[model samples]
Target: MIANTVRQFARVQQRRTLSTSVPSGVRYGKSFGATWLGDKGAWPVIGIIGGALVFCGSFISNKIMFHPDVRITPSKRNADIRDWR
Candidate 1:
């Protein structure tokens, strides 16, 4: 009798999966909250990688821009300027 009661309780606790189709990106409230990684998810990783790439690209660009023969100061504004000579 005790085994039968335990089996009944176990059956009550079992979850059923619905056969209905689920729409893409349709996040139920609790499921959405449960899936959250508290801001440590893909966005942060992409931001960090993108930031590093941008910083490195800017550094290389500045180096190329400021090369010795590539003077772009106001003194070299144009060939017709007196100071440019």
Candidate 2:
């Protein structure tokens, strides 16, 4: 029984060592942002342009939709609410 257990353990250890070995011709190296983004330097410019567009869009939309002078209807009922301002 002891000999059978030793043989089984030796076979398992051998299989594990063989499976963990790196395959031939496989190269590992450091990764850079350029690998995914095409150009690492352009990220900052892209971020700035995107941020500016978002800010300007929100600002314009707010000014058009929520300005105090702009009312839902240009009638006396709407004008009566101006006292709340």
Q: Name the candidate that leads on lDDT.
A: 2
* Model 1 lDDT tens row, 1-85: 9999999877766633233457575666656445554445766776888899999999888876865545577666555534422
With a 3 Å backbone cut-off (N, CA, C), the pairs that clash in candidate 1 are none
Global lDDT scores for all candidate models = 0.66, 0.76
Candidate 2 weakest ten by summed lDDT: 27-36
Q: Which pairs, if any, clash in model 2?
A: none
For candidate 1, what is the TM-score?
0.33
In candidate 1, which residue ranges exceed 4 Å CA deviation? 1-40, 69-85
Evaluated at residue 55, the lDDT of candidate 1 is 100
Tell how far residue 65 is off in model 2, in angstroms. 1.0
TM, every model: 0.33, 0.40
In terms of TM-score, the best-performing candidate is 2
Q: What's the lDDT for residue 69 in model 2?
A: 66
lDDT at 17, model 2: 92
Q: Which ranges of candidate 2 are over 4 A from the true structure?
A: 1-36, 70-85
